[model samples]
Target: MADEGTSTKPVRPSMGSMRSSSFLQDHQQYRPPNKPENHYGIDTVVEDIQASQISSPRQISPFNGIPSSENPPKIVESGVTHEFSHPNCTPAPGSRTDRLVATLFYRSSAPRISNAIPSPQRVPSPPRAPHSPKISALDADIPPTMAPSSSLETFPLEPPSSEPEPLDHLYGSHISPMCITSFLHLMSTFPLPPNSPSPTSAHRCLKLSAAHENHPEVVELTLSPAPSADYLSLADLRKHELIYRFEQEWNVDVALRADTLWRRYPRLVVFDMDSTLITQEVIDLLAATITDPPDLAARVADITHRAMLGELEFDSAFRERVKLLTGLSGEIFTQLRQVLEVTNGVRPLLRALKKLGVKTAVLSGGFLPLTSWLAGELGIDYAHANEVVIDEATGRLTGEVKGRIVGKERKKELLLEIAEKEGIDLQQVVAVGDGANDLLMMEAAGLGVAWNAKPRVQMEAGARLNGESLLDLLHLFGFTEEEIQQLVA
Candidate 1:
């Protein structure tokens, strides 16, 4: 089959040829060290045929008759042997050559053929993009510096600034009628404004005035003209609004000022005695004094509730309830007085008010006997209420009211009278109550406080206290805890 002048002697093979030949022979007879019982040697005939094919490239495959020299074997670490053709050789599906190649490399532990030839030293992969830690949805809007720390040692601390930073300019301020604890905490983050009005100069602005001993609740300060000049941004405003609007646990209310809170301090404080100063409604307790009549107490209580809710006219309700108590002995007032409960925080509140020279008056729609007694007990300066008529002969209730019914209109008139008598301006008076009857007086005062009042009263009140104590009212007036403690001490 040789052509004339063509050399029949085999061409000298390269080093790769010698190594692949030896490896093939060694692998043909090889058995795994762990399984010496198995033998995987190829038959002599097949070995001879494969060697001839390797020697002569033309005899490798019959389909395309490709030369073996063009397509060499590449050994990869994955235990799969790949045959690389000159351009490329794609074995046809189900072909005899494809099956033969598959059988030759079936899960064999043979050494990689590429190891025989030196490969270019591996070039390391480029460093991956710096990892970005994911943030929680709730904290996505928070600054990275403010994010929660996993460990105390890893927490970042701010380095001291080389230069002193200017104070945050005053934008606007709001005083919550509730507790000052949260408000004080919020203010700790920002420094007090510079060149801001002082207590003495605050009175000059007429919009805001300095906090004084008389009006500890008043905080009057000037704001920068430009909103953007202040450290409190619009977002911070929104946050403050949310905090104020949803604060329910504390009983204080809030008042906002764009410029100042320049107003005279309250010189007089008029209280609705029944429920404002005292926890019990005097009329309800009086009715409860009728022990002999089971249904009488319940009936009087219903009328009292309706009148406070504005469902019934106070005068008519008072008369109806008083009529039910006609047969009761006058001694019942003594029993009722023994069980009267004072509103929480009233003692401290009164003491604070008294020290500030704020006069107090109790305008009650209940009986005068109890109102006057409560006034003396609480050290209140003035007391006014409707009188319950008592028969001198029997020493028992006459089932009638004496003097004018101290209804809603009368209460308002009394408030004006008291202010005038005290020689104080109407604007310098504070009124606190919980019923429809007291609304007129409440409206007449400079500061109207609805103390755990009906919904209607609360809606109209300047400040509403729905919390545990009357002490929060002191906070609204701008009294700090230190000042309060000093006063108490």
Candidate 2:
């Protein structure tokens, strides 16, 4: 044989497209049994659709020239089931379903299929034309991706400029700010300073006639200034000095925030019946009615005074005092009622309160007989007090309290209960008292007035009326001279 060099060139397959069936038949031996029954029917249909897409003329693989032994992938009617394993082509490890899904998706995507297409040559695409002048300036300003897809127009996100709104448009100049005005009203117990000018030039003085001929001489001083930031504090300071000076010198009782207070017009006015609404302590009077034993009367009076001054507890002192009246005739109550002296300003004050449709109540630690009589006489709306047990056989007091004692706490409870019954706010209540037992009820009220109270009570009270007349309280609620005259009329 002639010596010849062995051909070294590798033969390339003809550059012709292979039929889809022939390509799939080549890998038939590698096909697995039908997919598990659990596999979704929709997945199988999706696989078939992808296979049809990949079989198109534009999607032929460029590496089809490679022999099956050279790690060619196995193609099924659905798609490539498995990629051939070789030193350079290691298949990704996954469940059979995952592999099938991935293969289906890979062949279905147009871009992926185009990239995998076996193209002999690539041609460059033509450059895009520039936008025409007929297009809107706004359209030219927007990028192609962001431009509106349809003919629908778009608006700018914000206005190019803003103008200030006219003040008249927002709020009419005729409008005024919201406000609450309080007026301090003062009335004299005596006629001193009959023509005195108001403490401040901004304030005015209104003279008021006595509610009755027998009532004390009275006048009204109205303090109304433009509202200020520190109006309450300044008013309090001014009123405090005004009260101290007039009360000390001219015997005037000053009432602050009276105007606003009168508007509320307290629905209830609770009085401590003993010393507040009346000049006498009913219990002391009862004890004094026992002339057969002077020492017992003195002892009861001493205990009562101590209790009122906060020395002894009112309940215990009251029990001790009532115990001494055991053998006293119940008929004495009638005589005591006859002698009971109404406090100087009480009748006039009650008259005004009643005229205003305000409810009056007497909360007493003394016996109910006296309180009931007083309440009836003054047309009081309510009365609560301790009941003195009586021996019906003898027509005399048994000296034992019959029911719950009406102490300081009970007084407060009754006040609250009454307010609730009347459907009024506690802020619309006025409590007046003169002793320690009256403090709690007074404290519970919106306005606690200590009327010639003990040192402790006067110190804690919201307002104090030291003059002889309780009618001074009317001024504190902003009752004007004309209003008082109208009320009296």
lDDT of 1 by residue, 285-390 (tens): 8777677678888998899999999999999889998998887888877777788899998988888889989999999999888889988998899999998889
User: Model 1 — TM-score against the truth?
Assistant: 0.51
- Stretch of 10 with least lDDT, candidate 2: 98-107
- Give candidate 1's whole-model lDDT: 0.61
Candidate 2 on 1-489: residue-level lDDT in tens? 535886667788873665343344434455456855333334435545554333235554555656565566665545546665442222237611100000000000011001121111233234324522232222222222332333335534432232222222222111111100111233222122223322231222233223333222333333322123232342344345444443322223343433343334788899998888888888778787778786887898899889999999888888888888889998887888888989987887888888889998999998888889889999899999898888999999887998789998899999999999998788789999999999899878888888878988876677767755676676556555567657756
TM-score of 2: 0.52
Task: Provide the lowest-lDDT 10-residue window in model 1.
Answer: 98-107
lDDT of 2: 0.61
